[model samples]
Target: MSTRHAVRDDLDSRPWTGPTRRYDILKEGAIALAIVAVLTFGLSALFSSPDEPALTFKGWSQSAPDNMYATMVAEMSGSSETAGYGPPYNVNSDGLSIGPLALQKWFGVTHPIDAAQDFVIAPLQSQQQPDAVTAAVSQWTSASADQRTAWATAYEDALNDPAGANGDATKVPAGDYGPVPTLAAAVVAMASSGAYDGALASAGGHFFNTDNTKQTMLMGDGSYMDDLATAGNLQGNTWGMVNETGSWPGQQWLATYSFWYQLPMFNNEDPNNTVATVLTDNADAIIFAIMFVVILLFVFLPFIPGLRSIPRWIPIQRLVWRQYYREYGKR
Candidate 1:
């Protein structure tokens, strides 16, 4: 007989003569269950998720009223990031693309946010305001688009000038801002009183008012959210993806996803570099594609030819069965 056939026949005829221990599967399962339960409850209580209070427009306005005012003006001027975000919002500019795919644009404007009206005008219109504030809103809505842009542009420039008021809304240099300042001031007042949060949330006229898109977008336009994120060390550059707020362990499973962002091409820190810019622009799509391929490879690893043979070639199993090998000699 060939060596392989002889070995298989010998193994088939062989009888075991080794020490054995009694195993009660039911007892073993119960012990395992008790241990797992204790650990689950103990660890969960010890490392519960952070319970920070939800951020509010009222809080933001109270903390940084001047920043809020500038954000409102930016929205009205159609200069805010959301205003030109393009696709899934508006088409003012084309969003990130992968090669010639224009993947973001293909999705189209699903949410359809008119930054000026939705973030600033709509919320204000929903709430009761002074006659001057109402008139300012009317003036804004009635003015030509160019007129509104010009007014907002002039006000934003003045608001941003550090040597001037340095973003202090009340002290901005005098200009032909028309009624924009009045409208902005009204929104600030709303935010300070906490009524602005309700106004934006209930803008859809729903009693439940669960959707917070408009409120979040408005807050995102200001610096307050970014400030909070930086303070918590939750910025993407800080490896925030796997980090929970405070000292708690975050989602470690996202390590693979966050790992790519640490690389230069994906970081977007150097915007002037052509390659970095291209990669950053398409980072989302590219990362997703890479992850998909990685997942496929992982799932098919057992079926791959050379890869599947690695376990056998490495022969780590010999270590596991060392006692048997010592007794019977290497098979």
Candidate 2:
């Protein structure tokens, strides 16, 4: 009877004393919701929407028509990040990988497209009364590779000389230069006239709904891209391209890859740029993925074996249930 009374006295001395009305579930939920709403609105107002640059071919053409060829060449040179961007663009190029694996090429030229013709020539051909431009393009098509190279080389050289503020390219000196300049001029004129986008519309006896190909090609041109890079401070030293006219964050995720270009290893290495870019991108992707997985595991580590026992080992449990220990003694 005395032992029973002692045990009852110990239980009475303990602190918990069953469920207390300390917390109101509804009140806590309302507070959490209010905090979340305030944060969401604040972030929305502070950061705002993502920046979208007004970089249309028409705008570029109107602004700098003389640099069309330089623009075209740049468009041709850069890697088409969207070429095989998959679904909602081109079905064939979708989901195919390219690199050492060559999955894209092995898939057999799916969505077979001639970047030059599709992006440049086709748009010009669609313009009203495009006979002269059409004739020049036809001549270019019939011309030999040497002849085309000669024209391009000559025109490219001619562009080096400065012209008036109106952006008129100096005429090429008399030579065996084919109809490339004339064709290129027509494209410039179309762009200048603000009909470039309208010409891009595939409404004339052909299916040309997809504008991605043309836009991609247009963005690749070196001179145009250089202009844009300059405007946006995307050049190597300034960092990868950002939206030229806005405060939004640029490609922050590519900070590492951008940093690699700053190193001496990639600097002054033009010929190896493609290979280096591909290798660096692949390596970075793998490393990031591994690190992400490691972080996730670390976050949930408390539930893992050999880790859950840490709480007990550290005597934190003893501190938490000190009243129970005082009455019942240590386990």
Candidate 3:
């Protein structure tokens, strides 16, 4: 060989036969598409989409009228979760915090909710009830705030510990509960008959009150929805946000966002037994603040000092590019 050709030249060192063959690109594309479509159809037929039916007030009221009534009574007395919940709902809201931050209070009241008046009284007043219910409503609306609370408190006690009638508004004793018992029980009956749901749906925003914010809260304040969710292993601590309804895969990507709920501080039990209302409400605000931090971190990851250097430090790039090195690396 000549001295010039004998030199180790990268361009000259590689070998090529210049061989060629006709490839049916269109045919292969069609075959691939058909295979994917068939696999998709078969899988869909074998296992349909996982869709749990929505829990509605109508269903809840019909299933557990007593429980629903009890929940409403608690709400009326300002003892329910919704009543005490912070801004955008009502004042004197509690436990909305993350370290020194009070996000709920800071966010202020955007969508206020008067649990008793909004959930029960408003719905009852929306429809034409019996003469007795009408009388009770009259007294209730005209009564002073203290008088209203007194009546509601008495009814709540009676419902909890019945003297003559059963709790859950089935029947009531001839106690000083007055029109409170009558009104509350009538509300329960209205709910059970599925009238209350429609009333609630139309209560807040006039003819087009399609938003279910208040309705969902009414159920959430009670144990029914939480209990049902718990049964389905959908509690925050259960990693339920990422888990499926059945033993199947779900939105596992949400694990990062839902992880805070599983934390010890956020997962504490309601020692007061008021239930998930207060805790979940507060946890939601706090988790949102933390999630904001997480999102900021993610968005700025590439710009962050040490964080952006992770790929360079780890050097998995070598492994990723190993095949290219073996095929086309310099001698």
Candidate 4:
């Protein structure tokens, strides 16, 4: 009896040892990698690539039907980038003085694009008799602003009249228009000859074969951008630039900023659109700063006082080790 009692006491006091299996770390790692590979392959097959293909200037000029705006875009691609962009296009180095106050203006002269020389003259020079185009470019450049304006205005009016397809613009009443028509003709010829891309490339040190800048300028010139803006409900009416591409999620985080644009004060105000844009820009900066601070706080949360104590306050420890608690309680 004494021996049996002693054996029973030893069994009770001894540490509980159940499984004694060796863990192969290499085998576990290999198995994990295999599972990840299979999962990755399945996901890849399920989801395809996301690519937003854009049309180029050459493509649009070839395909787009003759419209008032389309012709305008084609014609204006030379000069429009001047009035359209604030600086770099115009060589306004002081434009970045506004900083975050005018975030758009802050990154000044980063891209030094001379619209007329790059878009118009360069493209024309790409073709045969480049010297002739160069001389014409020189004449246009030397002309007075009033002369250029007169020429541009007259040409713009000429475009308004119903015209032929991909041909010479109808004759303008011969006046002090100077070499305007010739320059305009040069542009048209460049477009017609499909050397427009060559001209644009010439401006970018003849390196960029892509027609992105040319196409963008073209789109803005014609009512293309206006049409797109209208279609996308980005017009000032439908709450300043909400994502209008049919049922797709918008800038979800910017919903509040968008909501401000819908207000009567913003909607009805004459310069509300500009005001809203500025406000949104400022608000975005503030929101970004707040988010950054929050992220930093989260990163160092373990060292934070109140946050570190949250685990104890919630007492999740008791639930996780409930069996150990029961055993301790029984003791």
Candidate 5:
């Protein structure tokens, strides 16, 4: 063997005989865990927001009845965003796709949702209503699909009109709307009285309901929750995705993920246009794809060509073991 190789092999075989101290690993670990727990509890109690009341459909409807009524109309008409969303809901349109890969469709409609039936019709059917409301529900259910669509369209247009109801179903002008106006009014009343919330909660057919999917979907169909989100600075542009509802620290580590959204390249030029980037309407998918690659790069950093040399170049280990080096050099 060469002199250098012989020396290296000798060094490798050498055992440590330096000054040492007894270490009780278990005791050290227990002490560390106690300190960490105390610090965690202290910091969390000091910084975390108090538990706030959960936002409910009843609270939403009561606070913004006009918006709620408009949302109800949209749900009934099957024109809401959720209604048009395909795959897991219904195949109204192919949902946000990643290039040619229709991941949403491939998964299939695991959680089938019909906006009109689930949000409006079913809830109304389950509720106790007046004679007129009952007649309206019967008329709506018995009508042909085309007739129902026409009635919903006409009523929606009237609601949109500034001179008409303008979101207030009670003030909508008379038209060939069938029993839509009556049904809309009944929904508004039910929502106002908090019965609609109960009806949606029990949609899963359980005495003690836990499924909140229907309730959440119904809320998403409205601008009420959106308004609240905006007010709380929880909008995506505001990095709300990583934020808490009140004055509390959020997922700081997720700041990297949220950074991609702030870029102009990913931002939509027009609010009317759903296509945010060249990825079309799938900005979320594109962002996720980018993040996935970023994560992979991080995971395989040591295997990457130039990246693998970074540790050698920076030599942070020198600083970490400076005391050991000092003691060795003294010898």
Candidate 6:
């Protein structure tokens, strides 16, 4: 018989000579469970997890009112990031196109959002704006699109002046903003009442207001989260998403993918007009695509010609099973 066949037949005929020991599976399992439970509770109690409350518009508006108003103006002018976020949000990402790879646009506005209407006017209407605020909204709705744009632009420009310095609505100088200032001021007042947040949260399906999408989107301008994130090194530039704040080493494991977002092109709001910069603006998509390819390579490692041969060349598995090799003799 061939060596392999002889080895198999002998193994099949081999008698069991190993010693046996009594074992109580239930007892052993119970002990293991008890030990694990104790360790889990001890560790969890020792180091409490991040239990901060969810970020809310009320907190943001109260913390940074000027920033809120400026963001509102940006939304009205369609200059906010959400205004031009392209696909999935229903608007063009301003100019986030890449050599026909407008994948976001291809998906096409699954969740439509008109920033001005959704974030401001609708919320105000839901709160039942006071007569002055209501009149402003009425005038705003009745005006021609150009007139409304002109009004918002004028108001935003006025707010940009020294009086409106530091995003504070209290400082804005007099301007030809028509009813915009009235509407903006009223919205700011509504912020104090937190009606804006309530209106937005309640805007979801009548059955359940669990989805806080609109309320959350209102803070997308980034100013609200910047302070906390920067302090925690959580911003994209700090690679904060992957790293922990302070001296603690955060999830370094995520560095592999997050590395792409740290690149200047991806981090910058406008890194000039180069093609690389354009690609950077759409870094999320690019990174996802890259990760997909990497996953495909790993999944098909055995099928990939050159890559599949790496295991044979390196043979790291031998190191891992070195003791077994010594016991059985090397194949």
Cα-based lDDT for every prediction: 0.85, 0.59, 0.78, 0.56, 0.80, 0.74
Worst 10 residues of 6 by lDDT: 90-99
Estimate candidate 2's alpha-carbon lDDT, on a 0 to 1 scale.
Answer: 0.59
* Pick by lDDT: 5 or 6, better one: 5
Off by over 4 Å in 5: 1-24, 44-49, 162-165, 271-280, 329-331
Question: What would you estimate as the lDDT of candidate 4?
Answer: 0.56
Task: Rate residue 298 of model 6 by lDDT.
Answer: 80
- Separately for all candidates shown, the number of backbone clashes (residues 3 or more apart, or on different chains) is 0, 6, 3, 1, 0, 3
Q: Tens digit of lDDT per residue, candidate 1, span 194-241?
A: 898888878867788777766777778889998998898787767788
Q: Model 6, range 163-246, lDDT digits (tens) per residue?
A: 455455667777677677777667767876777667776774255677655566666674887788777778776787787655
Which candidate ranks first by lDDT, i.e. highest? 1
State the displacement of the C-alpha of residue 45, model 5, in Å, after optimal TM-score superposition. Answer: 4.9
Return the clash pairs for model 5, or none.
Answer: none
Q: TM-scores of the models, in the given order?
A: 0.87, 0.58, 0.78, 0.53, 0.86, 0.80
Model 5 clashing-pair count: 0
> Candidate 5: global Cα-lDDT?
0.80
Per-residue lDDT tens digits for candidate 5, residues 1-331, read: 8998898668768985567779899999999999999999998888865576777777877898788777777777878888888878788888776788777788888778988788878888996789999998899889998998899888999988887677666678889988877787778789878888888888856798777776777777788888888998777777877887677777778888988877765776776655555553676778888899999999999689998888869989788878978977622
TM-score of 5: 0.86
Model 3, range 1-331, lDDT digits (tens) per residue?
Answer: 7665566343456674434467899999999999999999998898877888887777777777678778877887888888887677778464467656776577677777988789877888888889998998888788888888887888787778844445646565556665776666787788778788788877854887667878878889887899898998888888989988876688899999889898766676766645454556478877888899889999999788998889979989889979766877723
Model 4 lDDT per residue over 134-222, tens place: 67677777887676667666665555444522323454444454555566556655665666655665555656465455556555665
- 113: Cα error in model 2, Å: 3.3
RMSD of each: 4.1, 9.3, 7.5, 10.9, 3.7, 5.0
Scored against the true structure, residue 203 in model 4 reaches a CA lDDT of 56
